[model samples]
Target: MRKILLALLVSTIGFSQNKPFAKGADVGWLPQMEATGYKFYDTDGKEKDCLQLLKDRGMNSIRLRVWVNPNNDKASGHCSKEETIIMALRAQKMGFRIMIDFHYSDSWADPAKQFKPKAWSNHSFPELLNDVYNHTFDVINALKVAGVTPEWVQIGNEIPGGMLWPDGSTNHWDQLGQLLNKGYDAVKAVDKNIKVIVHVDEGNNNAKFRTFFDNATRQKVRYDVIGLSYYPFWIKKDYTEVIADLEFNLNDMVKRYGKEVMIVEIGGEDDKVENTYQLLATAIKAVKNVPNNKGLGVFYWEPQGARSWSHYNLSAWQADGKPSPALDAFKE
Candidate 1:
């Protein structure tokens, strides 16, 4: 009883800040973006005004993707670590909590392709491991220097199988286990309080999730959050199918794995964009139990499309030349 009383006292003093999210509650939503669209640069570029735009829309957080080396690309612009730190600082000034996504690659690293950056391309296995550790430490420290502390940090991007491929690939859990530890330790080494997440793409595929998280746990690497990406188009036959699978997995992950579940990235494409709003609404509704009880909130993968609003991607909010059903889904 004394221990319980002391614990309550400690929490009362430490958690004096506002937390819309209940300790195990789910009523909170983390409205955010990949934030690559803001084009956070100072080369006399047209101000994108993304921070102000999000503020007006009631978003509480921003997720920024950090690349080892950035080059102009169709999918991701490859925002450099420095550029990302500056952008995160700007968002912090705007009062938005940050979720720093480390791609650990020079370009986009998803479930399909987890490419090793050119720098780590020729390094030996041991050398590559150290490289990842150093890179992780450096990025976190850089964020501290910029006065932008991240609330959540993803060690890798949508790591469906494994990252750094072949060597750090999911196909090989033994080596993958070591790599996971290296990244997790590096983050904890700097600040034990910061949340570390290992993200995977197959949120609906309970089997895949079980296999992935099960393997990671067996490997002995502890993580605070289980980040899952559930895009209707990418994961299943359609949005409905994905949502059904999501509901199943949400309960399964939390129950079976005993770790908090976070839907880090989720959205539909043009083919499914016709009823995208309704589809997303239904999905969000299906997971309403998360905010008040479980930690389940979905983020619209990348709301801002490429350079100039392009029609190819129904993923962007401006694809329709204005807010479309896809963009409207978030407001619900």
Candidate 2:
């Protein structure tokens, strides 16, 4: 009886860890869009909850980005800790698994720019490390207090070059690795089961991932998953031209690093519904094809962030407030 109980416990734990393929959307702009009185609708022209609409389209998870401290701008700002917790709780209440993306900056943090949050601007390298740990722990802990724990927490957003700039940039890979590990430690401190992801943009470019992750491995940066952003619209290549490259890169990363992978961000032109539909399908297929189910999932970046409000052409939302057919790919 004792041995049988032990085996049952092990199987239960493994089952909990092996979640279903995460069909998701990064709706970081959602609360702000709703605050600005944006309305979402279904194909039948009935008003609908955006979250519910996304669920209706078969999204099982939701991604929210958190900024350190942001202005209340609709398009450009406001993913503060308070807002993120509220959104996470709401999504969780709706049965959506949550993934929290930490931008670490007051505003945007990505390949082009990763400026430090205003409060951390003058901190020394050591102080910056503590800042990363504290800030990450604080937000995640608050979510825990609010009865919403994320399934995944990304240390930094799209940091191919690196994040927190200067000291934590690729120019200082050693420091960046330390910073990433600090964030990783903090998340585990809050909840060990929460997988930590290190994100970078340009998922199709194998060289970029190799160089960055090679540095990460050399520095012993601790993380559970590799996160990628694949935007064919931004790359100015059709998904067809670069998708095989993405598949190859996905397999390579899994083989090289012995880590799971996820396409954490992807989108196509909202107007090109059919093309975007195909893009979504192919992107999902590429990730699903990763051997041994190492490809965790694919997430459309801001599908509910309509182009009319965001001025971003890549949302899977139509001008009429209904989701485009592109999002229907998730249903499969």
- lDDT per residue for candidate 2 within 153-237, as digits (tens), equals 9999999989998999999999999999999999999999999999989999999999999999999999999999999888789
lDDT of 2 at 117: 96
Structural similarity to truth (TM-score) of each candidate: 0.82, 0.96
CA lDDT, every model vs. true structure = 0.68, 0.94
Please give the TM-score that candidate 2 achieves against the real structure.
Answer: 0.96
Off by more than 4 A, model 1: 1-18, 21-48, 72-75, 270-274, 306-312, 319-321, 325-328
What digit string (tens of lDDT, one per residue) describes model 1 on residues 20-56? 3311111011112333333422123344354454444
Task: Count residue pairs with overlapping backbones in model 2.
Answer: 0
| 25: Cα error in model 1, Å | 21
Residue 184 shift from truth in candidate 1, angstroms: 1.1
Q: Could you tell me which residue pairs clash in candidate 2? A: none
